[model samples]
Target chain A: MTAPRSTTTNEPTDPYVDLPVPDQRKQQSWRAQGPIVAMVALGGAVGASARYGASMVWPVAAGSFPWTTLWVNAVGCAVIGVFMVLITEVWAAHRLVRPFFGTGVLGGFTTFSTYALDIQKLVAGGHSRAGLAYLAATLCAALAAVWLAATVTRRLVAWRQR
Target chain B: MNWLLVICGAVVGAPMRYLTDRAVQKRHDTVFPWGTFTVNVVGCLILGLLSGAVATGAASSHVQLLLGTGLCGALTTYSTFSYETLRLAEDGARFFAAANVVASVVAGLGAAFVGVSCAEALWA
Candidate 1:
């Protein structure tokens, strides 16, 4: 998978990004959790299904390295990064949505076991350098992705508010 | 094809993660995120054993899907781990952020090693 060359890092400037702030006209409280939870569940279902579909389509070829896993993890990380920012800033998506898409779907979609297995396979195949490189790249990229997404989303939200 | 098993495993694994995370939070009363750390490490170990077993022809694809795809898939969560670590860093808990990184990577790798060894021993 192709990596995003530049990372985003602006925090949301929108005062009311995702919160349904209370005012004389309306009040927001824990009561909103019910609907939020439902939204999360729905997002989780979609995320999980997409993950399964990806795995099925990109099955590991026999005796080959874990291209399928590498692709999935990288893509999942990037998507979560974007989705997190989108929901938080742009769409001002509900609070429950993160749990479904981020925690449930993306969390399930990205597999540490496969990551470990990929490295093991590389070492087993006498490609120790490649294995280590893969590991380093995956960890660094995944973390940066989230941060960048968060920063960008925050900025986008702020701009929208202005 | 075995969708039922995968779903069941995920349900069990997810709730287990939630309860264990809450328990860890309750006991430690710290921001260390011990629960996610524990789950990831343990998941890596179990997955390692499963992978080893499959490699050595001791396990079947169905078993792999059930345990690997369903259970381990649900058990270990990278997103939460990433988000928490970032939150820690953002909140100025730099030490916690560093600890989160070292602990997860090192322990996760170690657990996978143990699992592989355990599975190999079974065959040996």
Candidate 2:
């Protein structure tokens, strides 16, 4: 998502590198998708397992705030910010690397579904305050984490390159 | 056993997300990230339904572990969503960044609630 399209005012966010060229989608044949999809799957398994393991190790008690998931999501968001910057700007790595690590592993590791569901459960369980707090906190934390991480990573990369 | 179920579900769920993202993204040329948006909402909906079903005994814990914990968890992602939003802001598309966050949260929460109600009507 860090594609340098900001030079032109009309340029849209060329977010994901995997997106096929507009009107040239036919070029992205099914064959090109095989390895990317496989890598995503493989990375996904590792990510989901790690998440499950974390929850197992630090199980959120019934009716308690889901701090574990909040941390997981925040950490994932931070890591992604750094990773996206490095992968898109600094690293000239393999193509499959982004799809595997970024889209697959981190995506699987941090879940929006559980976050939403947890808030729902908290509210339904007579913990509306906790739900509201969590709802706001996770959003704030995720955004802040990504913003700070990306900023710092960019600075570090620039310094090293200089 | 539970770990295996989660892994199996993730093996399928992650790829499903990638392919779905590709399919959705290729359809449009906008940078709004509708691909991630769609999957998050859909995943929340399914997880909500499963939660309701479990609450009402319509689904077992095993199924919940497979579908809810593994499938929905892998299908929807906070990292990508946040990263894209960050990119939009960095690229000076501030409006899109704000809208992306607001819309995703509202839609995701709404879908979760709707799914729960639907499940309550159907199974509960």
Candidate 3:
């Protein structure tokens, strides 16, 4: 079972995890998810509000390099790295915590739409250098931030466990 | 107030994302994270159209605040995308991890451009 699980024709990315079929999923009523949904919504409110507030405090004019959004996404990605590490190894986070803080807050805070559009606008406005830079920089920064944060967190957690 | 509009939009967008993710995940057992990919691309598309509409005077600033800043912002997520990519790489799925990054960026950017062009055609 273990051999087939990891070495099947499917790549490592295709997990062997079982998922609920449509019929089984239909059995899960929406009303049953009220609390989880509420937590996600509440966390989203706080996260989105924070992001909007950032824009207000350091407003970037249109057609400019959207440094604010880039930083926001990078910071959010870093936080998620720490958060996920803690939840997985250090703390057995509450079930709601993952959905609320992880999915809702972080997800709300770091935006892909804005990133894409920033590139589009910059390129369209003839600031192709800034556009290309923003595109690559955001991706690199966000990914590096997450990877670094996670690795550091894991090391810290291991030391603490020791 | 501005905060209230954003909060209102976020409350809807966030839950919509959670629900959509759950729904999408339930149908697939892959660890490739198609759920996040779908939401990110869809969000970019909507935001693209909304931006174009605003530029063409078809959409108001308030709408942009509600839908673009709050809804679309909450709908798409760079944090989750990067995190998932890291996970894939760490788990020895380097190819999948790279594919996820490229596909998400390309598709999301494509969607944004398409939405804008569509809006410009209709409005401009």
All candidates' TM-scores?
0.77, 0.92, 0.91
Specify the highest-DockQ model's number: 2
* Candidate 2 per-residue C-alpha lDDT over A67-91 given as tens digits, one digit per residue, 9 for 90 to 100: 9999999999999989888877888
Show where candidate 3 strays beyond 4 Å: A1-28
What's the best-to-worst order under TM-score? 2, 3, 1
- Complex DockQ, candidate 2: 0.60
DockQ of each: 0.26, 0.60, 0.60
**What is the per-residue lDDT of model 2 for residues B73-103, given as tens digits with 9 covering 90 to 100?**
9999999899889878887778889889999
> What are the clashing pairs of model 2?
none
Cα error, candidate 2, residue A66 (Å): 0.4
Q: Write the per-residue lDDT of candidate 3 for residues B4-34, one digit (tens) a residue.
A: 8898989999888877877775665555678
Docking class of 3: medium
True contacts kept of 2: 0.73
Ranking by DockQ: 2, 3, 1
* Best model number under lDDT: 2
Quote the positional error of residue B49 for candidate 3 in Å: 0.6
- The clash count for each model shown is 4, 0, 0
- In order, candidate lDDTs are 0.66, 0.86, 0.84
